[model samples]
Target: MIDRRRVLKALSKYPVYSPPFHNSEAVLSRSEIAANYNYFLEQKARRLEFLASYLRHFFVELSLSPEALPALDNWLLRYGGHLIPNGGEVLFAMNDYEPAWVGEYHGVNIIHDISIFAGDYIVMKNDKVRWSVNYGDGTKRDYEEIGFGQPCLVGLSHFAYTGNYSIFHGIYEFCYAGLRRLRNGGRGSKWERDIPGELVRRLNYLADPDPPPQIPVSQLTIDD
Candidate 1:
């Protein structure tokens, strides 16, 4: 029983996101960026908790009825202009060109590219995906394709068509693994680097619920 009305109403508020070409304003200084980055990192626990709860919500609430296929399509239509996190642009970068991580899945490098959108993961704020894991093969096959790219839409869309519960479960597991890794302080990626400064600023802007008329570095801080 997906709350169709509530979800649609929430989706209506977000304008289609358009990435800027280049920002000409003076970039945040290293200290300012570090403050924002620290703030973002401090929220990792909350982010993981929200992800876990949302996964449960998607699984338990995204329609398990006779007319599941139609129900899924109705929601997918509302998600128009939103790209799932896969090879698509997530947060500040498009990860299609390279594999961010490589990991053994049942003995081989079955898992290929993994992308994480470091945002609040709120639809009203236009958050798309928390993270996505792509398998080695360049083909779509339920969970093997893109790991919970759009959880309910992607996973349930396949389940509705095939009527296979295992496919849906696999996708859930893939997404949960990302949350587990994040809790352990790594992005489940090959690189153990900090997020880029440009992305840090963008995230600060998005997370600001009441942004002032003009943005300032101090406003981005979450002091002790």
Candidate 2:
């Protein structure tokens, strides 16, 4: 069981940010020089814990058993795509991974985090990323090269909201679906490879040119 009070208390503090992310680079550097070296480390651990607890809270609230959830480390190692800093927000690769973080910016509390799902068919063509389409607005954007650990927003995302269980549940279902597909010898797309099940139904849908027409049961001829 997660302590909601603990999470809320942590959120009450000023958010700490660091390198390979947004403004955290400076924070990390400054802390390393001025503050105790362990200060940043402590902050990092706190952030990870709060985020994990936040997700766990939702899992329980949605009636999902704790056993049904994978360990955070295992989950991230398996499906964690990449983390990229966008302005003041950090974007996570997988759908259900987004967690709420409270930070102080210019004397105000700000929540920073996001989740991005790329296109099903995005590919690199001619030294440029082709087939990249915004999953939300359907707009297209091109990128020459994506940096390591940087986010590519060639798809849609639900940005910076207190966790929504329905969305998480949907992702969980896709992951479960991917597992079932894997058991049946189906391979997922590059993005789906880590999390597997998202593309199974989509691929099946695309494979069939025409779906059988529906007929009313009353119109069926009786064999007997």
Candidate 3:
């Protein structure tokens, strides 16, 4: 479990700033760093325990196997489509024969980390994204809407280009506090009370999530 105090202590030493996602260079830089990422991925698995015990509703797992690549790939297309730093470096490409996700999930966090310090690393990071690059499919629920990671990724992008980490603080406060509330059985838990069973039911069916058909009692049959 990530000690709340640790996350809080890490966050306390920062101040907020207006996100620089509007600046073309910053957005492009964030994506570029995210795309060709290669570090600290193993750290993400540390979050799974807390997520499972405290926020079991959102916990979903994908068993890794060389043969199961197709399913993992398909799920990635939907989960990834827009957030993929590289259009071609699909999830499978990032993994090998290792039977675990290892550090794969850490890429975004690495991107998040780099986006906070005040500096421009993109020139060396991705010369191709020299000025700007358009992203997302022009819809209400694009990447950021999909998860808090996207916004944190952008917030760090804002911090990196502008030298401020408060954007990280505000967004994280909302997400973390919500998680804490659910953990402590506090207020604002109506949604959690309502959706966990449904989430587990659906996730359990990840291989093929088809709804069961309804039938009248008269049609029911017992097997001996």
Identify the leading candidate in terms of TM-score. 3
Deviation (Å) of 202 in candidate 2: 25
Cα-lDDT of candidate 3: 0.28
lDDT of 2 by residue, 1-224 (tens): 03324334444544434332332222213332233324333453454444444445334221112232344323332322212112342222221112233231211111212111111111111122222211122223211111112222222222221121122222333434444444444554455434533333332222233424445566675532
User: Alpha-carbon error at 83 in model 3, in Å?
Assistant: 22
RMSD of each: 20.9, 16.6, 17.7
> Candidate 2 at 172: error in angstroms?
18
Candidate 3 Cα deviation (angstroms), residue 109: 5.6
Please list the residue runs of candidate 3 whose C-alpha ends up more than 4 Å from where it truly belongs after superposition.
1-25, 29-135, 138-185, 193-199, 205-207, 212-224
Per-candidate TM equals 0.24, 0.24, 0.25
Per-residue alpha-carbon lDDT of model 1 for 74-187, expressed as tens digits?
322222112223233232221121222121111001111111122222212333222222222333443233321221111212112222122223322344344344455544
